[model samples]
Target: MKSVYPILILALVLLSACNPKSTKQEIALGDTIQTASGLKYIYLKKGDGRKIETGCKVGAYLSLKVKDQVVWNTNKLPDSLFTYLADYSRLIKGFTEVSMLLREGDEVVAILPDSLAYGAKGAGDIIPPHSTLIYDQFKVLKVDAPKKFLSDLLYADVKERSLNAAVATFQKITEGEESENYYTDSEQLNRVWEQLSRDSLYAKAADYAVKFGELAKDDRLKYRNVLSLESMGEYLKAKDHLEILLADDPENKMMQDKMIDLCKKHRMNNK
Candidate 1:
């Protein structure tokens, strides 16, 4: 029995040697690559060599399209890796697999075949089954781990760029308003203000508002600043600021409600 075991093992080794090691195969337009009931990738590069990994962080901008219609697009905006792989188990098997294989600054387009994409079930109301999807991805950046990835403009360098953009956007919107752009309810103006305020860009917010004589002139923008201060845990200052605004604009219902809420929250947190 022992001698027979050696022969059996030898035979199995010979059988395994019959198949070659799996490798990547490149394809061009009008080409089809077959897979073994799973996802496959085709990597393109500007230079020679290839990058392959089991798991890595990729900073990229992606535009997803189904057939001829545009579905989702980040359009050159910087997006981090964690945004896609927050829950590994929940993501489609193909997306998880392909993403894991990507490296930093590596851009490639993927053709996710139906079986590896939505499959028979399909993505409800959007992606359909037996459908081919084209993903134009450009890997603008990469990181070692998900935690190390930067998505929001919270980084010192990124924050600087965002501040500049915010300032520019604010000036452009306020250019047309003589009294106050805030009263105009301009979406562009509101968006720039909201982002600047939400990110605690208080000084930048104040500078832009004060430059055009817009901050002191508009009650709404002043209220936004008050809310910004409150969010930063400057409770007493925020409340005082709100009170001053209320004294001037007593009929402002929004300001009144906000003041009430901020003071209540401040009291509860202190208690």
Candidate 2:
């Protein structure tokens, strides 16, 4: 019986160590900080460079876990880095708070209560509704100056409720840059214009598409311009731009289909 006592004690200790609840308790013991917004974080390694700034581009490696089980890891990402234009409104609240506090070489573990995370709706299949998220690791690798393009500034400005600033920034882009790569690619420009349209800045969005067509001398921008004009209910202007685009790429089946649709809409509007 004396020998069995020691063996039983050892078995109990082993079971406690293997229990998943222990892992959460261990993490909770780390130095913690709470924000007014209810976000809680623990600094595993605080960085020692300039702190992150609004509108800065951030590159980070993150691992998301729930209940001590990893749900996602940046290791699967190309180059193992997730680069984004940091806008607090567009990201999880807890993540935005931690990210704004970090600099290059910083690492942190953040616990996001449901309110600061996906909340009641949760994320898609991987995260359950009302689940608290554990960002087990976030390693900040780079914090870069804001991109030169005004379109890149729009979301942050809008989040800050500085719609006038966003308009001013877009105006600067319209002024044109000396660099030939001022407009990086057609796809990126199109996305920015789409965001503007969503924000109800349809006239500015259409103007950007038209101005980019002139600046880049790329007919594709005219196609985008037509779409923007259509969104604004300027069917006559849209049809005119569409005709210009069709003249440039008569064999483009997508443009041909758009032309057919626009003509039908235009005829209906005239009646």
Candidate 3:
């Protein structure tokens, strides 16, 4: 996927360079050696060889600048690489390359050309076309691998989990009816998916909630699951969850009023 940051912010690249290990073949580019893919990567430093897996708890402290101008950067972003959902596909090519090379407590400054940086589109208007972007990435810390179910729960993998969860949810929503006959609120469904992306647990829980919503016949369980999906910024999902709960309990004026206020505050449709 392209950078998720707004156009003005400098999205990171995947790992495209590594330590000075000799390969069977080598090529050259301007001031850098080349690979068959036309990737001219420079290894600024070596990592400690600590492997980072998807869905692991990792944090990055870094400075980013485009040319001489500063774009957007986080002093330290506590990223939950823990879930398999947090994979290279969702990251930039250069970032993925570098991440593989890094271990716990590693750091490097990677210089990226527009081709490997943000490509022709660049990062919105902040990064110019064919411009170079620089990132000083540091693996400030990492949590121990998941020792329990929660870690496994947050682990991201390119599997059929999402599809299965969605199907299961649809089945429950339709009872004995076929999936083709279901009345799905697509906009609401998308909002739920987007909410999942904000953080790890919520993402996993949302998936579970969708699956549960599909399979569940009890109103009580759905209501409780919505509470489980709550997070710092998952107001949209919360409201949507509440709406589902409201469908089963129209007389619960307190929840109805709370949903109304949350919708108004979030500027989302109450429906």
Candidate 4:
């Protein structure tokens, strides 16, 4: 009997070693559904609003945890929600899977296996290797069309960079891409540039102004870039841009007056 017992115990140990299904016990607590992609989630509440789809611009509030430690909490930020285009390739596998199943006002708590979250390498300084991420809360707050989303993001929100990325996506849908161009053609590029400058987002305005100048090789866009730089108090850089403009057209009175004003500011800044 003792010999048989030893054989049985050894068999159980080997079976457990060969099979990793037992690891699910760690995340099986509470009422949770293990999705097809291995995302384990508990639906805290069901939403009655708009459904999420491929191009839906989404907003959500999240509290991410690793074991007992919190890695991210939206409640601590000035705005309680983070906005993103619901293009899953740009997001972690766990967030993508859960997001696809959500609608506006839906909330869920999810546990992402090590393979789905950060994989073996983990995120720098934020996640550890072979970590299981726990989303204590993920609440879908809003969903809107791309244009409406861009409008709200630009004039109302601080996520100007997201606006840029979303705009680039309109031109091409490459996986894991973020771009600052924010326009598909020269005409739209000018509109976005003018809008940013109107809103006093001069740094991004200057960035696009330079991009427009490079693409069209237009002196007017170059002058727009100079104006944006001047607005940002980059007097020295603005003066350099003015000098380039002057080199091209030394006989223009308007550009000459602009250069003189800029040089005085540059000299004062140097002093």
Tell me each candidate's RMSD, in Å, in order.
14.5, 13.1, 17.4, 14.5
Q: Which residue runs of candidate 4 sit more than 4 Å off their true CA positions?
A: 1-30, 146-271
Q: Pick the candidate with the highest lDDT.
A: 2
For TM-score, the strongest prediction is 2
Worst 10 residues of 2 by lDDT: 178-187
TM-score: model 1 vs. ground truth: 0.36
Clashing pairs in 2: none
In the range 1-271, model 1's lDDT, one tens digit per residue, is 7899999999988877785553335556334334565555555532222333322333456667789677777754454333343222246666665666566555566667776678777778888877777665534344434322111222232247654554454444447543241322332234445556667776655443333226326556666667666766777778888888889889989888887888888898799
Q: Which residue pairs show backbone clashes in model 1?
A: none
Measured on C-alpha atoms, candidate 2 has an lDDT of 0.74
- For model 3, residues 1-271, the per-residue Cα lDDT tens digits are 3655654253222222233443334322223434443344444444454466553434555566787777756643345222221232256665555555456665566666666667888777787777776774434355334222221221232023554645545545456544333223332343344345444455465555555455544444355456555543567777888986788788998787878767775775333
TM-score (all chains, Cα) for each model? 0.36, 0.60, 0.41, 0.47
Ranking by TM-score: 2, 4, 3, 1
Q: What is the Cα-based lDDT of residue 61 in candidate 2? A: 92
Clashing pairs in 4: none
For candidate 4, the TM-score is 0.47
Indicate whether candidate 1 or candidate 4 has the larger TM-score: 4
- Residue 200 deviation, candidate 4, in Å? 37
lDDT of each: 0.56, 0.74, 0.51, 0.74
Off by over 4 Å in 1: 1-35, 38-40, 46-55, 76-82, 86-89, 138-140, 146-271
Of 1 and 2, the candidate ranking higher by TM-score: 2
Off by over 4 Å in 3: 1-49, 76-89, 137-140, 146-271
